[model samples]
Target: MTNVELKEKIIEYSKEIGIDKIGFASADPFLTLKDRLLEQQRLQYQSGFEEKDIDKRVTPKKLLPEAKTIIAIALAYPSKMKNEPKNKKGERRGRFCRASWGEDYHRVLQNRLEKLEDYIMSLVPEAACKSMVDTGELSDRAVAERAGIGWSGKNCAIITPEFGSYVYLGEMITTLSLPPDTPITDQCGTCNKCVEACPTDALVQGGQLNSNKCIAYLTQTKDFLPKQYRKQIGNRLYGCDTCQQVCPENKGRDIHSNEEFEPDPDIVKPLLIPILQLSNREFRENYGPLAGSWRGKKPIQRNAIIALGNYKEESAIEVLEDLLLHDPRPIIRGSAAWALGQINTERSALSLYRAKETEKDSDIVKEINEALDYITSEVRYAK
Candidate 1:
């Protein structure tokens, strides 16, 4: 079969295998992306989770020799949950971002990529292919954008006309020569809602991000969250959606086409207090399937503690107190101390004092002292 015929067959088969969108691009070096990445590095803006070798990341041939084309795939995930649980007084819940709603997208996209790879190999017996999801060397967004999958939005997300920015991206590099699709025009004219709505101003400018200041990156960190950002994190247990939520293009774009991407309300929007008590095994068993759980239970539990503080839930004081005094991890204990300070009750203050006396971790001790000071100032102000 000719390359054009094979490409058409691949597109038809992609639809049969439930791939929502597919596009093709030449395996050229992403020179523009390389410049942006260099700028991000120079400005200390990277999230540090990306592949460090710039050459490998930008050059397709380094990943797969004689690569002729890249097949970019996008799968739309649900933006809204069905039968969403309400967060009430003592039963407040924290949320995982929309991307983390269902099964881990890594596995879901990998399965699709594998099937596509198998089909391609069957057609071209001598063809070589290399596939990767979000964790790959090549930038999935850059490939998708080049392949006319979507326009790169101001929020730094690829905004598909059909699915908005709510799509999971993956790509496959193949030796098969195929005609490339035209790049999409930027459609985000004059709309700066996403930039304005960023909670931490992590979007330094349109198409630029300072990942260190981003709540999505912060939620995945294992250490104690910085004092300034703790309050800004709100009830987000994993990832941040403020930028996407405020985008004009994303308005009324709630696609639920993929069953695998549908959320289990109770799991994605889990109660904050109950989350603090989940043991390692229990946490894994409950949240193991979701993409948000990749950072393990520590970050989620820490965010859950911050969410309780953000809510000022008086009922959580007991649990926060227990965590403050007895939790082995200093990040948890320190976060608990901060939460108690946010609660600012006399009982919470007592817990901080008790923890202050026994806490040997100097950092945690500092957190306890700060908590006590916050409560004392609040008490005096009230008086």
Candidate 2:
């Protein structure tokens, strides 16, 4: 078959193998990726690269020397899960934003991409693929735009007529000389809803994602989250789907995946009480299969407590207080104390007082005292 015929066959087989979208572009490095990469570097997020002398991404040419095209693909992940309340309830009512509520799309998309790649190699014995889903720092979003899959939105996610920004992107880098598709144009149409809705103003007025304030990066982060942005994260434990939720292009798209992306019912709008009580081992077993566990249960479970606090639900007080006493990590203890302050119950007050008496960590004791004072004031008002 000619290269054009081969490209057609590859994409057809890709869809048959279960990909939601498949398009091709040349293997050249991303045209507009340097500026974004520089910014990501300034924010200190560029550590995930191979610093070999050969310019790992665009050079040494041998690995991709004869490469004529790259296949940028996507698989649709469910936009919403079972218990995630619809937008009608009000902002921040749902548990997760949208895209992340399901199982990790990376694993599922990669598995399917491998099948397609294998089939291609069978037909062209010399074909080999450096296939990856969300790996290799190749700017999967950028390449997807070039391949006519979608255009990058102000939120930096690829958007197509059918899937919007809800699709998960993966790439197959290969030596096949597939005919490339024409690039797509930006369809944002002066829409700044995503930038405006961003709780953290991470996106500049135009359309830049300052990773430092992005909740998706913030929740998965290690170390301390700056106090200012912590509140902005609201209840998002793993990823934030807010910007996409408000985008005009994504409105009313009924796309959803029925594969490994299905969520565990308990995780959907989960009760903060037991989640705060989970031991490291239990958290592993419960969330390991899900993408939310990528940072381990500590950060997510910690954020769950914060989300409960954000709700200001008095019923969460005992749960937060209990976590204050049992949580081994100071970070968790500190967050629990903050939630207790927000809930402000008598039980929480007493626990904070007791914890304050024995606590050796100065910062934690201070947080406990703060929670105690706030809760005490609240209870007094109620009485």
Candidate 3:
């Protein structure tokens, strides 16, 4: 079969295998993207989780030497949960971002890509291809936008006409020179809801994102969340969806075509207090399947502590104190200290004082002292 025929066959196969959208693009270097990446590096806007080498990120040929065509795929995830749990006063819950609502999307996208790769190899036995999901050297959004899968939105999410911004993207670079698709025009126009609604102002302008200020990036970080963003994190345990949630394009988009993308209410909106006390193995068993858990238990536990403080659930004070005093990870201990201060009860103040004396880590000690100062200020102000 000709490359044209093979491309059509692949598109048909993609639909059969449940890929929501598939698009093709030339394997040319992403020249504009390279410039933007360098600018992001210069401005120190990267999330640190991104692939550092801009060359590998921009040049498809670097990834697959014989690269001629790129295939971009997007899988729609559920935007709204069914029978979602409610966060009551004492029984407060923290939320994993919608992208993380169901199974780990990397696995879901990988399964589909692997099938496509196998099918392509079967058709052209000598075809060379390399597939990657979020962690890939090449940016999935850049590939998708170039392949006409979606337009790059102001929030930096690829916004599909059919599924809006609520989709998981992955791509494959191949030696088969399939016909490239036309990129979609930017439809954001004058609507700046996503940029204005960002609590941290991570969205610099229309297409630029400062990942360091992004709450989604902050939530995944293993270190103590910066003080300003901690309060903004609210009940988010894993990722932030504020930008997408406020986007006019994503307004009514809620697709549940993939069962793997369907959320388990209990897991996605898990109770906050229990998370603090969970053992590492227990955490893995409970949360390992979700994409949000990829950073392991520390970040989630720390965020959970912050959420508890945000809620000021008096019931959580005991557990937060336990973590503040006993948790080995300084991030968790320090976050717990901050949370206790946010709670700002007499018991929390006393706990911070007791922990302050025993805490050897300079940062944790500083956090404890700061928390104590906050409580002292609160008490003095009240008097």
User: What's the TM for model 1?
Assistant: 0.99
lDDT of 2 at 9: 87
Off by over 4 Å in 1: none
Q: How much is 203 displaced in model 2, in angstroms?
A: 1.0
lDDT of 2 by residue, 205-317 (tens): 54567766778878887655566776777767777888888988888765754466666555655555677667778887777767767778778777877777777766666
**Residues 1-383 of candidate 3: C-alpha lDDT, one tens digit per residue:** 78789899999999999999999999999999999999999999998988878999999999999999999999999899889988899899999999998889999999999999999999999999999999999999999999999999999999999999999999999999999999999999999999999999999998899999999999998877889888899999989999999998888899998999899999999999888888889999999999999989988988999999898788888888888888878888988899899889988888898898799999999999998898899899999
Worst ten in a row by lDDT for model 3: 222-231
Least well predicted 10-residue stretch by lDDT in candidate 2: 85-94
| Candidate 1 local lDDT, 198-295, one digit each (tens) | 99999999999999999999999998898999989999999999998888888899988778999999999999999999999999999999999999
Global fold similarity of model 3 (TM-score): 0.97
Q: Give lDDT per model, in order.
A: 0.94, 0.73, 0.92
Identify the runs in model 2 with alpha carbons over 4 angstroms from their true place. 43-63, 82-94, 372-383
**Residue 342 Cα positional deviation in candidate 2, in Å, after optimal superposition:** 1.4
- Candidates 1 and 3 compared: the better one by lDDT is 1
